[model samples]
Target: MEMTGKCRLLGIVAALATATPVVAADAADVYGAPPIESGWKYQVALDGWFTALDGSIGLRGLPAADVNVSALDAIEHLEGAFAASFQATGDSWLLYSDFMWSKISADADVGPFGGTVGFEQEQVLFTALVGYEVPVNIQNMQLYATGGLRYQHYSVDLSIDPVFFPGINRSGSQSWVDPIVGMALHYDINDRWFVDVMADVGGFGIASDITLQGTATVGYNWTDTISSSFGYRALYTDHSDGGFRYDATQHGLFTRLSFHF
Candidate 1:
């Protein structure tokens, strides 16, 4: 794929940028972290989410149809997929990015047509963010506020297939980029464990009517450059135009293994 090269380049840059103090196992006691060293820091994280999605989609001459299912169910019918994340940091600044893509085929019963329906769904999402760590008086805690851009693209191909009538195929796509702002809070309970909470809001008429995302995680510092985390994440968006509408919520347990450098 043409995007393969771009993905690789992004990964490399993230690896270079993500090496910072958040993942360090040993640091001074200000917050169980040392002041950011004067070079590039990077991290690569692999995450898995047992995702469930709920939404509605529509085509020309047809009313919007609801879509709700587990990502595992969609993957059972998937054609291809890819997902990953990268981060780079400085003493007080950070850069992060992530990408996800999936293609699935599913069955939908169309109420208006009074027949069984089939559809293919393809989705791609990418987010790039830059954050600055804020000085906090609270002990053993770090706060960061960030701003970024999120790109989302979704497409659906519908087939009204049955023995009774001629088959009809309809396809439509929607893509948008929205500016987002959010905050992250991290607190170290001890040397080996920490907690993180984050939330973001976006899509102020830029694409969707509104969009929101939130996450909470507990992390275990395993080594000087490795950490593990488990979290719950949720994302919601409402988007509509004349012919295409995509309103959905995706939430699930998310786990990650991260490497720092």
Candidate 2:
């Protein structure tokens, strides 16, 4: 009787040990690791750089004025931006909203006509976009293509001081909304270092008018929760009408720091 009781107890213990792993596996299959959900991401960026402007002006018949201005002397500028985004890891999608403010000013002298042409340009852009991460791998590098819609507001003020006409001044302003598309390439050196390059193009009016922008950035993932990046960007704008047509090339360095939760 004593032997029978000991055998019964051992058999029950072994059965329980076997069943425990099955139960754990069933639980994992039913409710896997917690799903990554909606969260807030924040970023702050600063940019400083110079631009070059080239174009021509035709005043109906007034000798078809040619504008050959070097933006290098007038391209010193500063900019800042902030953004809030929500990420869904399972779908590899992110919804982001951003606001940016920038100021660019330069002093220029226009010859033969009269006085000095001083230029001041300011712009504010607000955008809401949805992006999907396309998975591509090359060694330790990853690439993604992102496209979205945006609303942009741009303004420019041009002041001209004439040597002949002592107090004559002229200025102009413009604003518009447009759509944009972009792609990014990233290389991971480790869990804590990466670099990225991106570009975008957009059109603003019924005449198929448009603008293009591009950026290249290098970043340091300081910690699992924080990272910072620095890069250079270029922007180009074109218009159909002669009065509103001008080409601007901006080359500047920018820095951004982000916190993830």
Candidate 3:
């Protein structure tokens, strides 16, 4: 499971229309609240992750087959990266979404003539999830199961500039969607402290070979309407289509600030 770049991006969503309070006024109230309502609760989260990517990619019509890349070293050529997410919660239900983007380019000397070979890659990932809470016996802990859809897009321009292979230029784009199923756990440690953990698995020949993700977060309530959190997330995906191939694991530390209404 992985989400990566030099710094990983996290997402947050606005509150949903529901019939419950977003946060407790104090420690005792954290465990219980009034019956559900029709109002909405939303959260916007901003995150940063020191993530590294490990994967293999290839393009058809190229002399070289698959090129291995490590986000650790490839990051040195990164031009930019960012992440963001949003969430909406209601009594017994929730909606969430996030986005991540990155741009990178690399250059290498090739051929006896000293010509150059290089490529520019841009990757984007977006995900949306919906879940329902199931009543459990554990006090102070909320448990839920979720279903989600994810779409990933990539564009690459590979070339051997000036000489290696005169008139050598190739560009391509691919996008796919995956359906995922998973669960989440939310526990109140006190009025101001809470913990959240989530895990998901998907892809059965419909999209990528297979994909999985997991997250753990510790959060502090700054106020009834605002909070901040720190966590870790990891993701893994395996895909091979036509002459394109990508198998990567991205993981690292993550931090976020959330706003609830």
lDDT winner among the candidates?
A: 1
Question: By TM-score, highest first, what's the ranking?
Answer: 1, 3, 2
How accurate locally is residue 40 in candidate 1, as Cα lDDT from 0 to 100?
Answer: 79
Candidate 2 residue lDDT tens string, 206-226: 432777777788889888767
Judging by TM-score, tell me the better candidate of 1 and 2. Answer: 1
lDDT of each: 0.83, 0.58, 0.77
Error of 2 at 203 (Å): 1.1
- Can you write out model 3's per-residue Cα lDDT over 14-69, one digit (the tens) per residue? 23223123343343376665644687689887766556665655667754333445
- Residue 142 alpha-carbon offset, candidate 2, angstroms: 4.1
- TM-score against native, each model: 0.77, 0.66, 0.73
Candidate 2 or 1, higher lDDT? 1
The best candidate by TM-score is 1
Clashes of each: 10, 0, 27
Task: Point out where model 3 deviates above 4 Å.
Answer: 1-38, 62-76, 106-119, 157-171
